[model samples]
Target: MLNSLLRISQKTALTLVFGLFSGLASAQATTYYFSNSGNDSNKGTSISAPKKSLAAATALAKAGNKLLFKRGDAWYIPFGLFDLSNKSGTRNNPVIIDAYGAGDKPVISNLNVLSDDGWENIIGTTTWKHAIYGYSKALRLFANGVSKYKVNTSDKLANETDVDQPHEWFIKEGVINKNGIVYMNTGSSLVAPKNVEVLMVGSKPVVLMENTNYFTFRNIDFRGGSTSNIVNIWAPSANITFDSCIIQQGAGSGIQAGHSGQGDLTTYVANINILNCLVDKVWSDYENDPNILLSGDGIFMLHAVEGGLVQGNKILNWGHSGISITSYILGVHGVHNLIVEMNDVSGGESAYTHAIDMNGFEGLTTHNIIRRNYFHDYTVTGHILGSYNQIYSNIFAGVTVTKMPRHSHQGWGVDWAVWRYRGTGPWIEAHHNYLVNNTFVSTEECAIMIQDSKANPIAVSNNVIANNIIYNFGDIAIDVNTNVAGTVIVQHNNFWQENSTEPVARFKNLGTKDVYNAAELNLVLPQYFRGNTQFNPRFTDVAKRNFTLTESSPTALKYGGTTQYTSLLGEDFVDYFGKKWDPFKPSMGAIQYNGGD
Candidate 1:
């Protein structure tokens, strides 16, 4: 029988060559060093003696280790909480926690550890000295002992004027009463009890990963502290990465992930990648009403986060909405691949804000991509106010939107009807987004607001509101209101109203506007248009608000119609201020402000 099949193929080729050389010698690559002055019993082996916290080298790191630290080391380590759960690393041995040598040196400070030993006043100091007395009662705050504030009230007061009064106090308990005292009508702010003495001596979180997976955090520098998040990453974390870190201040956030409580299935944090980081200020520690300062949000992703990539960060002085990816309540869900590219958000000193606030989430902010960013002085720059959020090629300067009144004597028409019912959820699909060739000099209102309320139909098709160049004072450039049945298809845009007596486009309908082509079911009307060549985009200098358009400006190439752009590159036509339109003559509107020969 052919010599017994050649001895069973030579014993299966020597067991596949010894299992590929023992998996290439067990993939070796380990390097640890923190040295806040070494010796956690040494032998972390660099030359036989290196380990000094990062929680003793992340508890003897595994999957292709590499901890580093050193460079100017301030290490600190006391007000604890650095849980990275099971821990893992791949993508060629990732698991780095960098920072060693080279400029910006080293300075990890406090690391959340604060215990000057005080606070044993066990609820004393004249009964917690009127910083907050707790009415609707439900205040939870923690650090080393873990818990990071959780207020739930029906009525609560310690003294920030009996919870700032105007009535909304649902309070339930989780008060640390820091006492910097600004809590009027409580929605955020009151931190400063010396930054709650580093979460009252390590109550919890200064980096805590729940169901861990591949991770990487480079160039660290998480200063000051109040914690609710300075990198939280909850749920089953997938391939996570945070490079060039700096995440500042922190009363509540500078990078956070999933599970805003109230669960089921518990979808873990998905493939996250936050690059070139540097978030600033950061607030929201909880006082609920001393006079109202509350409001702290900067990169917070909740619910079921899927593939996320928030690139090149440089967020600034935020107190709310500088990047909020939510899925807030009701059966809780989130989907689609999300991406917020090349970021450079700015000073959003909150008062009803947005520098990028995608809410409720569905179809995962649809084909998400907010590219080439550089938004300025934000109050509202790219807020798809929650349904199908897809904003592209950004670059807005001095953006503003102040309609206020959520409850302070309420009226900006009830704050635009509470900002149009804040969109109740699930409508997503704001198509081919390319808020075309951007450049807004000084906005105060209406830069872009597409309304569709009949229970969210969200299909604002083929968007390329081309070559934008606005400088409005009170609103109206593109505002579509579809009170019911919904379908917002505002075509081939190019509006230049540098205060050219306002009004460029506005369509009103409290109801009765029909548009249904559900593949030939027929009955369309709701289609507002104002095609190319409507004149006056001329502003080489609108009194220093310069909106760039003057070259016999009738808005140049004078838009025609054949609208179908998912960011067509070859035909030139690049508007939002980067100018370039007319690739062989096809420049009508939506940017191509003549860079094209």
Candidate 2:
């Protein structure tokens, strides 16, 4: 009897344990569907009966639930998406927001249209006015899905009677007890207020993740935002991801992630991945405020981010820099271990911007990698401004198109600058950077330049530049300051200037006010110069911007050995066009010269 009782107790304990795990599994399997045609009162567990709004679905969400929006549908939320604060998921079972039953991805915009009868004509003028109550400020105005020009003067809405352009608008903000007004001159006798929409900047983002963790968003089209980016992930959040999405048309950045306050590295947003997305048109003509620093960026990893990956994104037509990894705050913990690879960034001539800019405080930012990307048609290719950063195997081209008409600075292919500010903390300088195995072509001025913009004597030091092919440069091929002479290494590079009379390298002495050429530079700093030759790289095409090497090119065997660079870049890494590098002997430039020479 005693043996039978013990067996029964053991069986009951096993049954209870199994029941607890089964309950937890069922709780995690809850899936909610959202559609425009569904009713909210029904159970939202199936596609047949779905929820109608994000608020209802958000209220029912748990740690591992999936919230799927039906494709070919549009939702306009006046306040943007739900605020995902303190609503998190585990690493294995993250909260998901995606599309289903697709004809196209679901569109989520941040605007509210006025009714047809919501407009009133202003007295003795062709302009019409719409009064909006309880909103803070109007950011952008759209008529029939087209952006309108905003008047610069704030007094034009209340005082001007001769505003005649159909696409011009003005916003008069509210005072202590008044309502904000939006005025527009449609220049038509019949006013269609229903076709007009306004995006308000009420300190909200289209999709906000603050202090939340483990969320994945995929295949959603996000548009029409104001103050912040389309998707903003603030700090104390980790493992947030965005994949295969279209993010565009914002007054601010496209996608921004960062941490602020007290400079604590422990509170950083960690492991954020943005992959395979289309980010375009991230600037607005109405954003003329000089105080707004975070505008028109394709992807911005702001002051503090750790282990972030931004890869495979096509960024086009941005008004400012394409990808900016910056830590602008003083005494803040800087961005660390961020990898940016395989991106195609192109900008128009109207906007003078850099393809990539890494701005950070010295000794705080380190170990960031930039590799295998194509940057074209920008005023500057890159501004590498951090310590211990490695930039390799990339192409920086097309700054010579129209000479990017700037008054303050000359256009260069790659610029390395250091600035030192007087502070109580450590001195800021650019040191121990590696720029190797790259191709630079068609720059207006020098192909590569290093200078202390603030004119600090010892601001830049201990950098390496090796195994590059510089073709079709305007002025000097390589320009370095004299203060960084003994500490920098310039070796194993091929250079050919568009003007044949220019020197292969120029070392400017800031203190003595003298310049040194290739032979003169070799005499002064013989230890820093090795195997640098002046040769034509023999590119396949120059006018059409095809930079592949010809079979007879002399640069095919110019790289000396791979023993020094292979340990910096790991053993298994591909070249620019996905060709493997020979471990014993690699080619000179970004392309690995697969054809026989």
Candidate 3:
């Protein structure tokens, strides 16, 4: 909180006090508690007379209010919450809804799990179909808290089954049915798993922030939505946050931070902070459309949601990408000036999907920071697409995807691309972008890939990739395909290898111009060579993941005592180990050196 305060300007502080804390200064704060055992008619002032429903607590909630749900209590389908709007508290005393007196985190689910597995077997086949209360739109089925691929009626699941054959599902009429027999092998038969749950689509979110502001939700477990987000931030509000909450298992995206109302981008959502939240297991119900884009995701920051901090979130498996910060607009008012840091984005379930994808389809998405993240095991950890963004101080461990069979191209540890909006040229110039001081270890294809989308012809220029450390094993370390006419800066990066290999090679797909890392200068001087060196940045240990360099490393002052990198990588920053940074005397890669710092 103090760090945040220190970053705010004097004018911004006054606006926060007046706009966010107006309610706190005018009225005394109140505390309300809710529990499963309490009644709706209770005063809800004390724990004994706490309110029963979330509706009652929200109805009475106001600024400077603390709404605490009893731990181990749950608010199920029949009593789902209404949207919270029009009410807000000040920054000093924001309205907080949190868990109290815990057995477990308070659960707020929109669907009931089907515990009774009274499945009727088919006449001849080994298939089974169970009756369910069906609803309109797509239906999502989950077993063991994971999304089951909805099977098509025409696809055969019999001879095409594998060793660990997937349990594909298809809905028939108002029932859930499985295709083919449950035979895993010639002799053994597979039984239907008991932990089956279905969710309906098209409903209000479990916790809807419709035109709401200045509120904080803490330590609450939100799950089980029906084609709706566990939490949705609707249009035209700010100072809203979700902190330290368990946000998971929704039929749709975990958190939807936008509202496509009337197409006004100037009056967009801003100052939103999603801090230290656990967003996991969110599945988009695409039974209706499997080819749907921008659906299942951990956190979808859409429609011009800008200027916020998305920090310390552990996101896992919500397909289209773990975290997608985008806007689907064309003209102006782009989503920019955001900080996405300290998040652990891992494990992609969908093909050709990345851990994070920030596309500026809406407007010129620029000036955002993607730093200090630990990405691993994902099909593509991040930035299959982005522009004018700063990506630095992040670790890429066990990066996957030797080649993108989907895109008919090879994948890399870091990718940057920009697409024009509706074929309109110059959406956002991919200029002034930076990828610096990052570490990529044990990568399959390459370390960094910088490309200019065909639609974005020449705007993808003036980007910088510097001071990086790569343990790239295959192909090239930096493969830049400048299909357009501008140049990208590459310099001062250290490449480590076990065996003899040309790690200093710079392969490019530039039409007529050739670019290479100058050996004498030790920088990738586009179109010519100045200088380069095979500088071994003697590390303490590499096998145990200790990337701290030895005191007598030669790569110190590798940039030649130049502070030019301060603009690209951001100054006064800490390294991977959270040690303080000295911009002038900087070390390469994510972590700062005690001696090197």
By lDDT, who's the top model here? 2
lDDT of each residue in 29-133, candidate 2, tens digit only: 578889999878978888999888877866755568888989998777876676787767766567888889959888777776666688888766678888777
Task: Estimate every model's Cα lDDT from 0 to 1.
Answer: 0.50, 0.69, 0.63
Ranking by lDDT: 2, 3, 1
Over the stretch 309-383, how does candidate 1's per-residue lDDT look in tens digits?
Answer: 787687866656667776654454463456766577775444444566664533444444555466666654455
For candidate 2, give the lDDT of residue 248.
73
How well does model 2 score by local distance difference test? 0.69
Q: Candidate 3 on 412-501: residue-level lDDT in tens?
A: 676665556666543534566777777777777777776666655446667777667776435666766756446666666666565333
lDDT of 1: 0.50
Q: TM-score per candidate, in order?
A: 0.33, 0.82, 0.81
Error of 3 at 289 (Å): 14
Best by TM-score: 2
